[model samples]
Target: MTPDEVIAAWDQPGATASIHPTRGISEGAYWASGEAQAALLAQDIPAGSRVMDFGCGDGRVAIPLRALGYDVTGVDASPNMLAALNRHAPDLATFRSDGSDFGKHLGRRKFDAVYCLAVLIHHSHETGQQLVERLRAVVRKGGILVLDWPVADEPAETNAWIGVTTWSRDQQDQITKRLGLTRLDVDRPWAVYQA
Candidate 1:
């Protein structure tokens, strides 16, 4: 699907319902390992630091980080998603923007850290490069950027809904290098880069 189509699908009624709280774990838990991962990421950053969760669907990561006392902002292409996020996290800030061009929506704002999880794989290679550049522009020097997406040795496969494009380690290495980012960690699908 095109980027607009993907956004429309996500904004449809009940599109985000499945991600809401379940019987045991809450929605945030179901999305980001029950907030454990978010806590880990927030551990090093001092309280009140600014963080942005790019493609921050329904506050999965943003809410938890906010709860940890960081100034968190959730950015996504879907207003419906941002609305849903507001319902759960009313005080958290949100902005509407596509993954490939969030810097424009943010104006001169920069973040101490950025989270772009489960987002990059939906874009083609060219679009992904644009997204990396935009994301880089928003992150402050010496800040961190966390990325997590499926990776495989096989060629990337695009679905009828949100297209999926997998990247190999080499591809990711080149991206970090081009962006002048230092790799801090590499655990399978997750890579932490310091700008």
Candidate 2:
């Protein structure tokens, strides 16, 4: 799906489950997962560093990351998702985007790291590549980017909003090279790249 389509889909009711279906089964489990992810992010991004939680839905990860001492900002295309996040962490910063003009949203600003979980898998290959490139652009050189971009034996593109897109190792490597990203050897589910 294109970024605009994804944004529209996310704005509809009951879209949080599309972000993480099983995690939303219980509120305890849902927020616990965020804390766990925040812990993993903390290992790479130093405490108190400025960070952006791209595709952050309802402060699930952003809230916990902020509690861990990072100045975390939530960026999402859906106003409903952002509204839900604001309800929980009213003070946490947020930016509305459709993945087109991120630079305009952060004029003269850059983050130490950015993490985009459960986002790229929902986009087509071309859209996913563009999203990754845009994400890389918002971070400073040597900054970190953690993405839930998966790899499979056969590369595939997602046609639905809730579908998964997988890339081959060679394809991932090529994007890493093209984006000047140095893959980090991290013990996490998501791939960690250095800008």
lDDT of 2 by residue, 8-127 (tens): 889888887656655658878888888988998999997799999999989989999999889998999899999999999899999898668887889868899999998889888888
Determine the backbone clash count of candidate 2.
0
How much is 162 displaced in model 1, in angstroms?
A: 4.9
> In candidate 1, which residue ranges exceed 4 Å CA deviation?
18-34, 44-46, 100-103, 186-189
How many times do residue backbones clash in model 1?
0
Steric collisions counted per model: 0, 0
TM-score of 2: 0.96
Output the worst ten-in-a-row residue range by lDDT, candidate 2: 15-24
lDDT of 1 by residue, 1-195 (tens): 467776777888877764434414564457566376678777655578898888888887788788888898899998998987899889898889985556467667789988787677766666666777788888899998887656689747466444577878788788889998898854534677889
Best model number under lDDT: 2
